[model samples]
Target: MDDYPVHQISEVVRHVGTSDRNFYDRYYFNCAPRFDGQGQSGVDGPFALIIGLGQYPNLGVADAFAVLRRGDDHLVVRASKALGEDRMDTSVGPFRLEVIEGLRRLRVVLEASPDNPDLSFDLTFTADSPAHLEARHFDRSLERVTFDTQRFVQSGTWSGSVTVEQVRTPVEDHQWSGNRDRSWGVRPVGEPEPPGRRADPAETERSCFFWIYAVLRFSEFVIITILQEDADGARIVEDAVRLWRDPERAPETLALPEHTLRFAPGGREVTHAELVFQRRDPSGGLADPLRVECTPAVACYIGVGTGYGLEQDWRHGMWQGPLTVQQLRRAVPEIAPWERMLCPVDNLVRCTLSEDGGIEEGEGLFECAVIGTYPRYGFHGLGDVAE
Candidate 1:
């Protein structure tokens, strides 16, 4: 693949900058149907799709997975293959991703396989808002660098068709929207190693991770906010920016945004949330705070079987064999056991937002993760459910 005229480094494209075995580059995408006032999809049934592809340079592995959620049923298709020098070949078995245009358009295809005719899709994503580069994610645990990565986000409209159980459904750009993230560098991938002596044994009990990432897109602009906190409720990472639909307009960064989340009874599922963004005046004085209210419509559990890792046998960059493909169909009722075991359950929620007193209705994604001990949420330790 480096033979193509796209080399930036003196070494081959496969030769990454780092020698770390966990060095990786990945692409993640998600799309959900927009519901009308009646809480129904434009078509027959509501559905959401989450797809990802990852490459581990040093590990010599590449993998991809596509998950389709329709109502209570989830269909997952995963594939893994040994990495070759041709990094351009992103296909694994029947799944492949195409970069139609560098940053403007892309396509993902999951061909119907006879081994599992459960789900397949051919979706094209077109960017509706300018790509926003997020803050670098750098975290160290036990004096070891656990996560160091850079990612860019883009919200877009999707158009294509999906087939599930021999039934085909059309996805229109006007009625469906999604967000994609391209992240590279190092993070936890492949298999887990044996745990050595703990740097601090007491740290396990106080461990907590809270993350809230939102990409709310309206006709005029898009609101992208991210908040991450540690066990003590101290901010680890924060980003709040508003991007306009027009390319020329500059982006606005909110100062010290605050969030208040309301979870369902006895569970960590967020029912709604309120985000307050304080704007700064040109004189460097604090201006009025902009408030946005979010109400969720549909939710998808993203960590179960699609390689995010939650009691799942398959994981990204893990060498299963030369080539492997698997499928799973899970009913929502049967997911409770896995849900309880997984900490910081990742959820992709389709939500409607209302800003200020005007009630400007806009639909987008509200992604939240809450795990372990957080005093602010009344969760003091692991296995402690919300009231």
Candidate 2:
């Protein structure tokens, strides 16, 4: 098997991260079955499987989880362990994530345990497009700050098998499509205090956010977009990339130097979005525009299962070796309710995109978070008061 470069391993073990208490390194991926032979409407899949692993160096903890969503059925398996001295060992209990080749391929394995006999998988991901790095800067006020963040995204295919309830489903290379992202830096994690004690008066007055990120894969090419807006619907950051893959050569990125995005009226439950990308001519002149229309079909709260924000007992990276997997499963309700709820920070949305005079559809993740006070989204304090 291939191994990650030495420098990559060094970076993983580097203990001198920023001083922020929220600093973290994480791996995230989502996979869904490809659309059938029919047209755009034929692109319906039964489920989406999302897996994540996070390491909090400052806190000396690491965690991992897998969430499977099929219609109304959502199953989650999570595990956490102490950071220990060896950060290079990316394993928590039966969960292990390995990089086969830097920026090219990865292997993810989940072993079946008595506590979680219903889920397990051994999968490999091979990148089909070049990784796209994102700009990271969010400075609204002294109290609300986000900085020093770095992220890269790639669209790929999965090969292997997923065992659910002992029923194995083979994922052939090209039969399933997915996206994976690696991010490091300061962000909110762990549980929050009770609502009464967590109120911040200044946050509710002017704090709101809207974010959209999607990677749509077509037969010949892929389009990726990431956009963010503040409470008043003012643009904070935006960018889009068009990746074209040729059968005989490496994929190329078409420079979309200019782009614009418009979200539908309702800020909370965003169902529609319109995006236009403009490439510049060799002489730096504006060229014809390419437009994409999007509609969301399903969404999963980032805080649920993946553990962006949850109570201490249910949070990602929480120690889990004390209890058996089955005991942990039985204690889930004591930590939080199982019903679907909207969180302020992140959400993974499966959407359909229409472009290029043809309607090709795929699912991508989208996140909208308004951190301080924004009455429009019904956020009154630090928590998600909107729902």
Candidate 3:
């Protein structure tokens, strides 16, 4: 084990993460076909496909899922398995996630299985921009530390194919563009509440905010923005926005990005936003602003399908013990019905941005989870309403 390559060694091998029950490491990405015409496509056709893999070290389990939204259909498949001591092995049944060339490139494979015969993918992602790390301090509470948290965002292109419902769609380099993020930290994972009991509002308040993260790729640059606001839409706990010009050539760096987000009537969804890029003068005065206008087209409610804190059967790392591939396959169908009924991708928005007076359109993945109150996204009765 000592002789193993640095990239091949997993964090679990070194016990590097915190002892928090919710500690998790995850990989998430969204891919879609390149827009052909000008402006935003407006969610008229096949939207996007999202894939994720998460490892909960303390709980001794790992899980993976894939969701494809084609036209009016939303198809999803999930699998989970016990995490063995060998962290180097990143395969969970038919799903296998591997780093082919460390941060620069990685591969994901989902072989055909009895439970999800119509869905499988063999895709490789090559990073187009250097990974940009987000600020770690998210919550206001100092005592309840979300420890050892690290996140890196990258804009990348996908190459390979994904089969959905017996249809194989090839994703050539530059033809299908997307962004990926790697996050590892103490987050809520696994079954937090007793089976069939509603989660307490106080417990849910830990993450009671609406988060919007959009990564837009253009001909010359890339724009990444992240915003997190509290339950009453008062405090902005996390605000990170940046631009990378010709990211393919230069090393990634952080810059001050000023922006305003305007949501729709209910304040649950973003309708329009204006991002201004500026630099401070030597004397601390603001410089001329470079402006961009963004209009949302489509989005996905991430929690709906991923099951972050929703259900016991869908929770990450809920797998109890060592299981065979066939047994895992058999378990998927039992949860498939629940996935369809409860999990809906409400906001996977395809967006259009006007930058430098040119209308450049692209597809982006966005999600909002309002835990305590009546969120405008129609998740009213899902959980107990906080007072």
Q: What is the C-alpha RMSD of each candidate to the true structure, in Å?
A: 2.0, 5.4, 5.8
What is candidate 1's local distance difference test score? 0.81
Candidate number achieving the greatest lDDT relative to the actual structure: 1
Candidate 3 per-residue lDDT over residues 1-387, each given as its tens digit: 445665433553546435777778889888776666752233346567788888888888888887666665556677778887776688888989899897789899989888778778999999877687777735533356544466888888889998766778777886777889999877657876442322555545443545556676766566676655555455454444544546456533324554565544432345666665664555977655555566655444344445565455567667645643322222222334334233333444455555445676545554434433434444444343223
Clashes of 3: 8
Q: Rank the candidates by TM-score, best first.
A: 1, 2, 3
> Ten-residue segment with the worst summed lDDT in candidate 1?
340-349
lDDT of 1 by residue, 76-191 (tens): 89899999888888898889999999889999999988755888889999998889999888888788787788889999989998888888888999888889999998887888
Local distance difference test scores for all models: 0.81, 0.64, 0.63
What TM-score would candidate 2 get against the native? 0.77
lDDT per residue (tens digit) for residues 37-125 in model 2? 45212133446678888887876778888877655556788887778777678887788999999999999999999867888999999
Better of 2 and 3 by lDDT: 2
Candidate numbers, best lDDT first, in rank order: 1, 2, 3
Candidate 1: segments with Cα more than 4 A from true spot: 1-10, 44-46, 337-357
Q: Give candidate 3's error at residue 263 in angstroms.
A: 5.5
